[model samples]
Target: MKGFVTAGTLALAFVPGLASAAEPVCLTQAEATSLVAYALPQAINGTAKRCSAVLPAGAFLRQHGSELATRYAGQKDKYWPQAKPAFIKTLGADGGDAANLTRSLPDDSLRQLADVFVEGLVSQRIALKSCDKLDLAIDLLSPLPPENTAGLIALTMEVASTAEPQVGKIALCKG
Candidate 1:
């Protein structure tokens, strides 16, 4: 959060007053959901009919969509501390376990942001098999901000190579 930024492509390149001086603002679970909702539609074509066909935005996403989309679109590489508030709020009590599980994994947002980035993929029959896995895109290469991107990629590669999913596995990250 303290250092001068290394600029990258993604949304951060165009957003002003961010990526330097401090870490990017982290997206809340609600925000992530909303932004993912927002991003999902754009990422996938003809998907809106399905989402709208479903349960709707639910309560959290509907109320927080605009602000969440702004923060998510604005800050992708925010520092851990900066990202913490939103993560905690989003994950609630479940966060402690997830954070602890991947504490030593990596510094990038991959382990955390991956799910956020690609949750919508689960809805798609094709994206899931095409590019949803950690090996395909990796976290750093993902559209997310930089702080966690590189580290997340490393973690994903490690996980993909070493671990095998047994149960219903959902890696939690914000894409």
Candidate 2:
């Protein structure tokens, strides 16, 4: 996970002067932060567990938004039985609950995970047409490997933290 690239690193991954190619999927810092805040929870909550593949974040999202969403939509109705069961199962698999997994990590680790999660979501939003459809976005973003559940939860906690005010405020479980 430490070796995984961050947003700024993704920019560097492109050739110099090809700014459009490297331009982050989230257009602004606020948008990036807001997207991270919104998507992190749904990801860890297990709604995405059915996701079996690892999506390429960053430019992939920028280039293939609609195609990715359509491919991941699967058979579930746009309106579903509910997403909570998946979230609960994901949380349970990680550590029995969100608090148990998140409360124990070092603060810096959580923040680092938050940074990575932010990059992933911004890329996801860019690919999915700027987060217009919550269900679709959730499906597209949920493709994270199951091994990252703890990291995802830690990132969610860091985003939700009140002490580090720069991350901005987030509302979880809106439904």
Candidate 3:
């Protein structure tokens, strides 16, 4: 479970933006949850791809990664409106004026860019040894609705943020 949480935290690291000297931007729970929901599929797919060599043939990620991703992808359109502004704000905060260029892109284009970025980040961050654990975690959580799975990740992050002293570049607002 801790491994799962760690994986989720890593996946979210880019979503909220990297730590910086700038003051942190805030995301309401709904915004955070929506972003999680929007990102979950990409995260899973990225991890699965990165872990493919080490994971067993029948591992959940190996076997069901695409299916799980597709399931969550279905919910993305519903989550996108709330997620977009939060995403843009974090990007702008992290990248300064250069990030403002993203504002001009159509919603579809921005979504595609965000999706590719997340997939690459998740793929890059996952350690090889954690593959099996991540596979198991996704399998267990697969039964839940995407929103519930996202909520769980968001809530876990909230609890974790409060327990630590170091503030991130983006903070999830408490309900």
Query: Candidate 3: what lDDT?
Result: 0.74
TM-score of each: 0.24, 0.25, 0.83
Per-residue alpha-carbon lDDT of candidate 3 for residues 1-175, written as tens digits (9 for 90 to 100):
4664564554354253533326666678888788878888888888888899999898998889999999889989999998888777656544656676787788999999889977887788667877777777778888999899888876766655555444344467756
In the order shown, the candidates' Cα RMSDs to the true structure are 17.8, 16.7, 3.1
RMSD to native, candidate 3: 3.1
Runs off by more than 4 Å, candidate 3: 1-25, 94-96, 164-170
**Model 1: per-residue Cα lDDT over 1-175, one tens digit each:** 1111111111221111121213333343333333333332223222221133332344223333333334444444333444434333333323467756544445455334533433343234222222222112222234554334434322432233223331112122445
Regions more than 4 Å wrong, model 1: 1-74, 78-81, 93-99, 109-118, 121-175
Error of 3 at 50 (Å): 1.0
Scored by lDDT, the top model is 3
TM-score between model 2 and native: 0.25
lDDT of 2 by residue, 1-175 (tens): 2112222222211111112322212122222223323334323222122121333344333344344434433322321222222222222233555746654657556444443443344343332222223233334444653223223433443333223332222222322
Give me the displacement of residue 93 in model 2, in angstroms.
31
Highest TM-score, which number?
Answer: 3
Clash list (residue pairs), candidate 3? none
Give the TM-score comparing model 1 with the true structure, all chains together.
0.24
Q: Candidate 3 at residue 75, lDDT? A: 87
Candidate 2 regions with alpha-carbon error over 4 angstroms: 1-58, 75-79, 83-158, 171-175
Candidate 2 achieves a global lDDT of: 0.31
